[model samples]
Target: MYFEKIDSLNDLKKLSIEQLKILADEMREVLLLKLSSHGGHIGPNLGTVELIIAMHYVFNSPIDQFVFDVSHQSYVHKMLTGRKQSFLEARHYDDVSGFTNPDESEHDLFCIGHTSTSISLACGLMKARDLRQEKNNIVAVIGDGSLSGGEAYEGMNNVVEVGTNMIVIVNDNEMSIAENHGGIYQNLKLLRDSKGKAECNFFEALGFEYFYIENGHDMNELVTTLKKVKDVEHPVVVHVHTIKGKGFKFAEENKEMYHAGPPFDRKSGKYIYPLDNPESYPAVTAAFLMEQIKKNPKVAVLNSGTPGGFGMNAEWRKEAGSQYIDVGIAEEHAVAMASGMAKNGVVPVLNVYSTFLQRAYDQLSQDLCINENPAVILVYLASVYGMNDKTHVGIFDIVMLGNMPNIVYLAPTCVEEHFAMLKWAMTQREHPVAIRVPAKEFISSGKEDTTDYNKLNKFAVTRHGRDVAIIALGDFYTIGRDVADKLKAECNMDVTLINPKFISGLDTALLDSLKKDHKLVVTLEDGVLEGGFGQKIASYYGTSDMKVKNYGIKNSFPDRYNVEELLIENGITVEKIAEDMEKIIG
Candidate 1:
């Protein structure tokens, strides 16, 4: 009722503190009402309502930059930034992205979904503004869960060292997709419980001006604290304490469930989809790893701050004991730490998403790949496009990981291959392996795997077709299969389908065995086209007499469109492939 009259941020900013508190309540109700139908990160957004309002009211957005780490909390930002109506009726519509998108609104400085990137991006924006001689302040709103990320630490360390004029708001609601892990949680708890007094001084240790506030939900305190921090001359970290799922009883009870989700019953707090057959990578992977760690005492599991997000459960912690170490969200430390753990005789398995893996690229290349540490990096949602508008498109890992020496890239199209690769990767003692597990369903078969992947550079051919060769990478194999089936059934053309399980070291044997009669070779991957697996294929066929076309995501993407449409637009079409093959043969 309050927000109905309040259409703009200006109207919101004009409200009194009492009115602002009530506005937060109204916004929470509105969000729960809308998202119950569409499903979203209601708990995180609900908890952030007041803080987002305070940020908008105090800081001039679209001019003064605001970056939300993981960006799930941006739902309140979206409401205040004038995308509320789109959120209500047409939620899944292209206009209202789930994450922050600079293109969507200047209010959303960055479109990011992954964790631990706010500080780095914010620091970059600040530096860019300085180079251009711009005067606007750059603010990064990161959560305690995000602060666990090594990139955030590196970014904060860099920002502090350089002594820039910026505001880093630490939204310490004490959760990151799931209950956070590592020493930071203990430190955050200590500081959060501090009533208007400072404790631990974590950021202060990093050469940052630190200010800790007790209650982030209190609009007066939030605004007042922010105003005080904004007056400071150097880069500072403002630690604000807030509740996760502050209002909703169910969300408060189950903070993890409400982290980010689809629509649910507001009163019941139960999800629209019953907890049966949930589509999750972490749970599946963690469940399987528990089985492995039980069998092999030497096998261990690692996570950044996302132990819970990556599906590390209490049973594993209880059973595996110290074998399961959540390295916080510090991906760089997690990777290097896993390498060290392996050097000491433990087979460490690091479960991380492909996008977040970018933060530890240098460590992955220099520390593990160079020395050939035999650690297993299980990458979920690899080569991803727009799952959410957040800064988490993991489309670059395939291109990046494949080129790294002494590292094997395994793209498992289904669950059997997924678990199979996981098992194989854990036992290896020579080279580091990164498995690309796409967010598609698992194709499970009861068949046991007795195969040894000593030579990981191999491709699996699903079908034997003569006209055209469709080289599919990772989960993109399924999409290519659909295209191949369309070519076979619709146009009666036999299309060869090859799943290059190994992304980096392509099967030169398979490529060498290609027949001249098999006229057209099309490579399909889910990563960026340039410097991606498809381009690698184009490079493979560059000097040869083979005709090649590369298909994947192109250069820059900042919008939500049909995934199938994206493939078609990129020329990985069923009809187009059929027509091209027919022409080539004729």
Candidate 2:
């Protein structure tokens, strides 16, 4: 097998165009074998196989640095760079992460997960190379889907300043996680249709020499085109039109579902893993929003190009029609547009993943929060249950968004409470509301939540006891209840359990009342303790007699972590916290 023969770039360069084509076939076989048993990014990697092979064949990598945009498409690059065993063998599935990691190999320039920052990051590398008086080609391989973000424009704008050898390869597959959105796609279409001879070109407008390849799958064409721009003195963009799901039939037909999903059957190309819970948060949220849109015309659902994360399926998005907006991968634009919609007497619910919403901090603060626009922002996967990648951790929303002025951040513990909070936020017109949805499927309270959220900063005390009070935030409420129960069972202690629904505010009255009976107040949050919910409570009781103990993850980037093990290591478990409590309050 050519793939077995490919030990390094030197081995790759020894192969002819015909041999490289055979190598491409072998690489796809490895990709399919690994992904069929252990699923990962199917479409992106398949599409970029020939492109990456051509890149390795032309450029001297590790010297001629290549930065992938999101690195979801970097699987091919990884395979070519002495890590083919990871893809070829099922046992080595855990050897590498889904995204590019510098720790895994020196060939990977950066550990990137977020999109549209490639050109900008490559600029930094080029600048550093210039400083060191070294001459090497710095290339950024970005997908067409990532072009929707404003950062790509900013990056392209700066690339003109770097008058050196830098290549930006635009892999146009006409698909994002969802289908492409925004006007840039139209311009890209114009460029593609004209076949490199288009007037009013975006790349040319950015002051870079633009080259186009109609068939990006053609290995000969890719190699020839790349060699032309290899030693170019100035910045240039190589726009190549390729298929997203190139090799696999299932991936080619259903690009969205195959973008990234669970393990599948090799022969039939059917998914082997099934959704265990149909009543998941995404499913529930999709159902709720679809029903809401039918009742009110002004009620619009907006997502920052991540419909799957928010549970807005194809059917739901279709039914909503113009009421639904997929603002591409532009969170800042989505947030700002939601604010404008809210200002015009329309209730806009902007749903975004917690990590992606970090991009819109300025818009949330200056545009939405400051104006008191009464828009509902649903921050999904904003807990320890979210993705463990350093770039995409959802645990820092409390640190980033909680302290923002005039924004009401609500944490719902159960499904019923989440619905109640959503209902209230939909109708409320006085202030902007952000609901940090529970990460896991939560058990219902069995009782209707009739509490008025307008009277904000109210803490709901589930059980009353003595000595120690445990205040839980969001999904951690269940953990607090378990700790309280464990304390009772093991230590013969009846500790109080309080679910703090409002993360943006503290219940000062209830906190003051706790001082009378409670000697120690323990705060639990599903986030970092440093700039999060627990630290706010610690700051509140700084001068008080009640000793405050905060239990949560530390301020650091933890990649590919097991949730249960992370909790134990952070002293966030019921047993660990209970043991600490016994030592102090016994």
Candidate 3:
């Protein structure tokens, strides 16, 4: 009920420490109820309740800008800043995004979902404030896990140059999406053990005045610590050692699983929604990698910081032993390392989310693609169906990777194709191959994919027909199949359905052959239309007599979009395609 009085940060000024503590509990209750009903980043939100409360208590928001790393932990901040209904009520859960968006609130400085850019963003704000000759506090709240990223260090190194009012709050939760990895984590542990009295301090070494809070959950202590550095003339790092999943017992015990999860039972902490098909592309790829690594000493599986999400669980990772490598929130390093491994006759399969892979574009282009390294890069969640956020949209990977030369990017339609392509990419030594794994539920085509990838840019004609030729790339094969079936049944015309597995290049020979019988050529791809697979087809047939139509998502960031509705909106459904075919044929 104390949370009811909190319409803005000014409301926190009136509350006593005891009242603030009470408000934290009420806010947690709301968070628990909302997260339990609808899936969200539960652990981060629950753990940061006190920190956010203290932040509101100390800093003047809108004036004092706060940039959260990853922004998953900003749920508590949202609740305090006139968005309580989003967390408190079930109906209002869809009102706000899972990440911090400037469109949502004036308190939010940036639309951030990806990790480890807080310090840099805050530094920019500090510079802008300085340019305006204004005096206000700027804070960047980052987690211990995010420190493993090169950008965080880059930001920290540059932040010292400002020499003005800046505060970097390090929320030492001791975990990323998975358990923390890399040498920086070891130093963090040392700093935590030393109780801020250590001789070797990373923050201090970076020219930041360091202060550590042993009990980050304590409201009085956090407020006192924050207040001390609120008006500090120079940059400071307030290292707050806090529990990741502090209040909830389930989250405390299983930290990784609780980091983000689906709608679950409040009492039992069991998932309310059941996974219809648990056999995922990641699981299949993990199994294949485990088998390959066990047999071939030269084979290795690599992931940045997220092994569990990519399907290499603790057991599988242990089984992998020395063969498995987690570079720890460093995608750039992982890409570079994979390229190195490939150069030395080792086949390194690097699996990372498509959105996260955006960080290592330069590494992918220069280190791997330019060198033509044979490293197998598995791009997970590279469709419109992947994580729907402005910062984490997986639709742009096709545009990014496909543009790079000497990089063979393949999109697999089914589990068989995926594994087959994986096996080929692992063993081959021609080029750096990246496969866009489908975000849709994994399905077996029941037929073995024995297509020799050595014959690059060769499309497979699943069905041969007349009048219209449909080229479906990767995950859009199912839609293409349905369209073909509808065209045959309704229009009494069979259409040629082609599965162009390769996105990096067009099967121009096969495309030219289609001009004989096919009057209209249609391409379907599950990504943004611009700079995507469909665009390549449209470009190829630009001046040709064959009328080419490309169907795909537009070049826009859609937040938490409905998959079916999005498909319909993009004219990707069988009904829409069939109607188009009828019109074209007529």
Segments of candidate 3 deviating more than 4 angstroms? 274-278
Would you estimate the TM-scores of all the predictions?
0.89, 0.98, 0.98
What ranking of all candidate models by lDDT puts the best one first? 2, 3, 1
What would the TM-score be for candidate 2 when compared with the true structure?
0.98
- lDDT of model 3, residue 198: 91
lDDT of 2 at 211: 95
lDDT of 1 by residue, 284-330 (tens): 88778888888888888887755555665555577778777876667
Give the per-residue lDDT of model 2 (tens digit) for 97-183.
Answer: 888899999998788999888988999998999899988999999999999999998888888887787899999998999889999
Name the top lDDT candidate: 2
After superposition, candidate 2 runs with Cα above 4 Å error:
275-277
> Where's the lowest-lDDT run of ten residues in candidate 3?
269-278
Show where candidate 1 strays beyond 4 Å.
Answer: 60-65, 88-94, 120-138, 158-165, 196-200, 206-210, 234-236, 274-284, 308-310, 383-390, 445-451, 465-467, 479-495
Cα error of candidate 1 at position 496, Å = 4.0
> Candidate 3 lDDT, tens digit per residue, 201-254?
988998999999988889989988998999999999999999988888898888
What lDDT score goes with residue 70 in model 3?
92
